[model samples]
Target chain A: MRRYYVDYFLIFLGSFLIVYIVLPIAVILVLQIFDFSMLLKALQDERVLKALKNTLITSTATMLISLIFGVPLGYVLARKDFRGKSIIQGIVDVPIVIPHSVVGIMLLITFSSAIVDNYIGIIMAMLFVSASFTINSARDGFLAIDENLEHVARTLGASKLRTFFTISLPLALPSILSGAIMTFARAMSEVGSILIVAYYPKTAQILVMEYFENYGLRASRPIAVLLILISLTIFITMRWIVGRRRYA
Target chain B: MLKLKNVSKDWKEFKIENIELEVKKNEYFVILGPSGAGKTLLLETIAGIHIPDSGRIYMDGIDVTELPPERREIAYIPQNYALFPHMSVYDNIAYGLKIRKAGNIDETVRRLAEVLGIVHLLNRKPKTLSGGEQQRVAIARALAVQPKILLLDEPFSNLDVQIRSKLMEEIKRWRREFEFTAVHVTHNFEEAFCLADRIGIMLNGRIVQVGKPDNVFLKPKNEDIARFLGYENIFEGHADGSRVRIGGITLSSNVTTFGRIKVAIRPEDVIISKSDGEFEAKVESIESFGFASKVTLSINGLKLKALTTTSKIIEEKIREGDRVYVSLRGFNLL
Candidate 1:
């Protein structure tokens, strides 16, 4: 009887947070269902389409850049132990903890105006705030693999590079893919950093804010609903892909 | 042939120190040690996985201490087999050949798989295979490369008793067919006895004794080796000629030693009889082990263990707290 009470209490406490999270998204989607024609109109608007395109392109570029650099860093952090390794790991996690606006300001100061206020600057901002996800997930992925497999491959006449390509990299792909998806999602939702770095090539998130402030909630609701739908669709699809590949 | 002049490695908790060893061509050398004795470390050091701190390794009389494992042409199969989980059994067996870009890759893989009895498992992933099947795949994968020396670290330790014995017998046949030198490590006495051409008894990260199986089993080098070899009756005794005196009792031994020394008597050599024997002893305990029972006898403050068949115990009606006659057939001076 005591155990039953404890379980009920714990579940009640958890359900409050779950409702708190699901309520806002549920209300927005339900409200948009009544305004479905407005959503169709926003999807056809050139300005809205351009902002969505910019968001997709820049976020994708960010994801690719992060994959190119972050995966190797993750593998190194996972496999090697050297001086200042903890410091390196700490550095990888710094971007995640830093405020997104601070990330934009840091990127603005690091590069010249020629680089900022452009597509590159927007990508730089997104990558700064989101690369940590890829790095950490890839690190965890590599750590989950057995080192004995690499050792056996070496003894089987495979060079270290060959072993990495054939054994370690393939096994860690699912984790890496999930990390990339997280990076894409994080980049897409980024508005604070882009507002500071490059407001000209407006992302869908920045446009939502602009619409809300300039034209009130009625003008912004459709784009907000559209952004949520697209992000959820991509997120769920990517997760499904990763889940399928994981078991395969 | 592989040789280590003085290999050593130091880790935080364990160390393999100044290991001097050699394996002749096609010699099946087994390193027998208890867990944490650094058997795996020694094997890895020979495979060039971990470079020794301050010693040289020679392969066929050529210094290869600084060489990596890939260049050393050594194959290692760890206790878990370490089969590539992402690949099919066929691809695993063919991995080395593909790396070398050798000709007749399919033929080599098929031949090895056939010999190891894993031909039917060619298309299956390693995760789907049984332990025995996985072991066979690991063996086939390692053997496909035709390495100069095969280093197996407790290969059959994961299998059940029936499969373990079967694999042990098949491994002997595989070694003959493959004609490869091997350095196998295990803590099982039966494995060491059945498979080793020469046995090296490892204790505390050192090769304490190395000899033929019978000699090493019958004659251990020191007190520690004797204790590890299951000599339960060990005592410091004064020896004169072939007789040793231990605590108010003198026992006859085969080895001749002088003055103060340590002697070890295997429990199997301690004979217990009801009618006639050298000394009378009180049966302290009788523990049954299904087919055999270990009988502990106490005579004049000294304890000795004797192993006898369960049928004999039943026939003679030996039980705890009974008076029995005990005699030592032989003893080893340590």
Candidate 2:
């Protein structure tokens, strides 16, 4: 019976990590409620609106481009085996391992002067740092599906491409959607890459950084709190949708 | 007709070598082998799931060796049924039709679903259905396409014995109605006996023998096959014209041969007696097997087994360490 208390104490100690993160976000949210006018003013600011719009547009573009390229790569990684497959898989994970600032520098070197000041540059930088989530998640989703399902479709007079679209794609859609959401979130939160590549089409993260640098914590706190609030809301909603249909 | 000439494939641990097989139109061919005998690999190769390293596959006199699965018009029901978990039974059955944009999709799916007795399960996903229900759905999905050949990879293996036999009967009925050729693979001899027009026994990675069910079961072509088919006593012996000699015992054979050869006798064919027989042996062990008891007998440095009824065992007062007379009812020389 005394051992039970020890076990409970251990659990309580482990739960402090959750509290550590929740306490700061909770403090920020509660403080912003008292200074609600600052949040309203941040929302009304044309520069803030433009920055948020840019973030949304670029993240969505990154997600669509990730889907176009990542899904096929995911399927290949999941289904096929050839020489150097391990090397290919390792390369897919390189973005997650490397620093985001390095990714921005690498993209700049590869794309040269054309990529340094364009909206495409922002998307490319964000995609370089974030697309790993989509690719790995989609690969896992494809791996979860049985190879027999695809074979059965093939034996039933459906071509390979047809089987992929009709069976594998639909079955793995939930995981892919969840991955896209994460990729979008990661792209939205990206700051280092965007800061170097394209400063004109500033994302919300960069905007928050600019405000903090120009006018201390008071000016920047409202935008930071609003960004956190919106990100949390969208993240929770997407997760709920994923949980409801999590076949993959 | 479907034919495979020298079909071969090599995986890391399993390989099929020089496989030659033929199935006539509307024939039910069963490939019988023990576990790890490359049975599933051969089935997959026929289904085009695995491209053969070297072979030619023919269907209706057309060379389909280079054709992909879709172009070959074959339907494969894998061991686990492999029903799409995300799709409802209706959609699963309709998937092939939808892909091809075939005519009368709903009517065809409805008719096949009704035939397979899964009409009630059309709205349910595969995970929601019972094993038998899922099996029925898989069969419906495969049959909906009306392919040239249907490949069944141990379709009844995951079911209880009762369900297995029931599905076996259902498969026959469906085949008769649909008139489709099939290549069914299983390790169970009972399955081969129940559903096969012709059976092939596979060992290691080769089809050691192919014949009618009774022929293959009763007379395996070689010592390896005989051993695989549960022939208890197999001995290398000398065949001299009409008689074969094993150790000190000489037995008459209908096969006229000369020189060294292998002889096989099934356990059930060894007749055991208490009083009068040519050979005398001591009882080694007796094991009770429900309706029958398996008796092991040692004679002249040879071990042989016999299956006798439980009543006969009690009547004869047979037990371990008892002396018993034994005689060979028949034996095959290979």
Candidate 3:
């Protein structure tokens, strides 16, 4: 009886945060459904379409770049025990805790005008904020694998590179895929750094802010709904693919 | 043939120090050691998974100390079999052939699977196999490569008792069938006795003794090896010639040692008889281990352990306080 009461109380407490997260998204989706024609109009707008395309391409490019660099770093971090390992891992996680505007400033100082107001600037900003997800996720994925598998592969006449490709990489794929999904989602939702760094490439996020400032919430709300819908769709679809791959 | 010339590796907590060893071609050398004795590290060192801080490893008399595992023509199966969970059984068996770009991949895989009784499991993933099946698959994968040396690290430690013995028998048959040299490591003495062509007793990161299984089992080199070998009756005694004087008894040993010596008697060698024998002792305790009972006796204040069948306890009516005659059938001096 006491256990039942504790369970009920715990769930009631948990529902507060769950509802806090779900309420706004549910309200926005519901409001957009009532003004569904506005969402269609926003979708048809050339400016909106261009911004969406820019956001999609830049976010995907950021994810790919992160995958290219982060996976190797993650594998090394997970497998090796060299000097300054903890320091390197701490550095990998440093970007996550930094303020987004400071991240923009740091990139601005590091790369200067070479990346300013361009697709490279947007990607650099997004990568700065989102690469950690891929690295940490890949590290955790590689860590979860049995090192003995690689050892066995090596002993069975597989070179280190071959073992990595045939055993380690394939075994850690689900985790890497999920990490890629997070990287893409994080890159797509990034607005603060892009606001300071590359506002001209006008991602859907930037367009929403611009439309709101110029024409109030009524105009911006449709694009916001569209962004939410697209992000959710991509996120859910990627998650489903990862889940299926994992079990398969 | 494989040889380790004083190979040593210093791990964080465990280290194998100056591991000097050799395994002849087609020999099944079993390294018997307790856990944390660095047996796996030693095997890894031999397999080229780790480079020794000092000393050299030679394969077929060629220095392979600096060679990578892939170039060494060795196959290692860690405890739990370490099967490739993602690959099918057939693909796993074919992995080495694929790497070598060897011809007849399908024929080799199917032959190994058929021999190991995993032919029906060709397309099944490792996650779906039982422990014994997984072991057979691991062996099939390792043997499919036709490695010069096969290294197994406690391969049967994960299986049930019945399965373990059955696999041990199967492994022995497989060795004859494949004709490969193997260096197997395990903590179980029964496994060592059953599978070892030559047994090396390792203790505290060192190979303390190595010889034929019967010789090593009968004569452990030191107190630690004796203890690890399950000699329950070890005592410090003074010996002159063949007679060793313990608390109040003089036992005749085969070895002639000096004034101070350590004597060990396996519990099974200490015979407890109902009729008169050599020395008289009072039964102090009796502990039953299902099939056999360990009878602890006090012979003139010196405690000794003797093993007897449980049925003998009932037949002889050997109680805790009963008087019994004890005889030392065999003893070794260390």
User: Model 2's A-chain: what TM-score?
Assistant: 0.96
Which of 1 and 2 is the better model by TM-score?
1
Question: Evaluated with lDDT, which candidate comes out highest?
Answer: 3
What does the lDDT come to for candidate 3? 0.93
**lDDT for each residue of candidate 2 in B1-334, tens digit (9 for 90 to 100):** 8999999999768899999999998999999999999998998888888889998888888988888888888999999999988888999999889878999999999999888899898888889998899889988888888888889988888999898889888988998889988999998888999999999999889988999999998878888899888888898899999999987788888879999998899888988989878799999999997989899888887778888888888998988999988888888887
Q: Find the 10 residues in a row with the least total lDDT in model 3 chain B.
A: B251-260
Q: TM-score rank, highest first?
A: 1, 3, 2
TM-scores of the candidates in the order shown: 0.98, 0.94, 0.98
> Model 3, stretches more than 4 Å misplaced?
B254-258
Among residues 3 or more apart in sequence or in different chains, the pairs in candidate 2 whose N, CA or C atoms overlap within 3 Å are none
At residue B119, candidate 3 shows an lDDT of 94
Write down the C-alpha DockQ for each prediction. Answer: 0.91, 0.79, 0.92
Off by over 4 Å in 1: none
Number of the candidate with higher DockQ, 1 or 2: 1
Q: For each of the candidates, what fraction of the native contacts does it recover?
A: 0.89, 0.91, 0.94
Interface RMSD of each: 0.6, 1.0, 0.5
Ranked candidates (lDDT, high to low): 3, 1, 2
- For residue A38, give model 3's deviation from the true position in Å: 1.3
lDDT measured at residue B86 in model 1 versus the true structure, 0 to 100: 92
